[model samples]
Target: MDSITQLHATTPEKLTEAILDGVRKEINDLKKEFQPKEPDEFLTRKDTAELLKISLVCLHDWCNKGIIKPYKLGNRTYFSRKELVDNVFNSNL
Candidate 1:
């Protein structure tokens, strides 16, 4: 009666392909949902300072002293969020 009905009635192969395509898309979406999210790899100097509840100067000193691993991209400096958190937790004990 309708084009959709005509298509399904005339072409079972096409219908199967369409169904498989939809299933594939759904599977991919489910995979994405189930996948573990990556932790933040780098944090800006300001963000790191605020996160640690310290001043930028002290953060810089720590960075220089290797208390926190710092990465420099262009003129901007970044710190590893994981390392900072680890250092704080490890130091508390």
Candidate 2:
């Protein structure tokens, strides 16, 4: 059930201020609920290998076998830190 409350003898300025306050509160609540995502951190092949305690050859093998994914930029390869962490947690090895 919806109940309505009537405002009696409210001035224009007071009504405007009340409406503005409600809007401001709603905006603040929305801001509180919003979260900004951090950009993914990219690592070079050598850096990724070192982070995983693996050799460059092993890293290349993993990439070839699709065990780990790589991103290419021009002629260079890169790995994402988030993806690495996720893979490590999701996989047995």
Candidate 3:
């Protein structure tokens, strides 16, 4: 059983508070379940270059040198923003 299910309160105020708290928690859980998660975003070469504050040539050089991984689909190449953030920030730690 959930914590809310096991709740036992003597005073009316305490009982009311517990019920309200349980309802609130159930609403929050439903909201979390129904809410659509963000899709994985892929940045274009130009977008990635601008994000990194580097020139397009430099970005390509990094990709070629295997410094940063690239995702290629047909004629297009892309980079993951999440991976970039993790790589840049996690390296400092």
- Best lDDT goes to which candidate? 2
**lDDT value, candidate 3, whole model:** 0.86
Minimum summed lDDT over a 10-residue window in model 3 is located at 1-10
lDDT (10s digit) by residue, model 1, range 15-56: 889899999999999999999977778999899889888999
TM-score per model over all chains: 0.54, 0.63, 0.65
| Alpha-carbon deviation at 28 in model 2, angstroms | 11
Off by over 4 Å in 3: 1-9, 22-35
lDDT of 3 at 35: 98
The TM-score of candidate 2 is: 0.63
Which number leads on TM-score? 3
How many residue pairs clash per model?
0, 0, 0
Candidate 2 on 1-93: residue-level lDDT in tens?
A: 999987899988999999999999999999888868779999999999999999999999999999999999999999999999999657898
Name the runs in model 2 displaced over 4 angstroms. Answer: 1-33
lDDT per model, in order? 0.83, 0.94, 0.86
Model 3, range 14-85, lDDT digits (tens) per residue?
888889999999999999999997777899999999988999999989888877889999999999888888
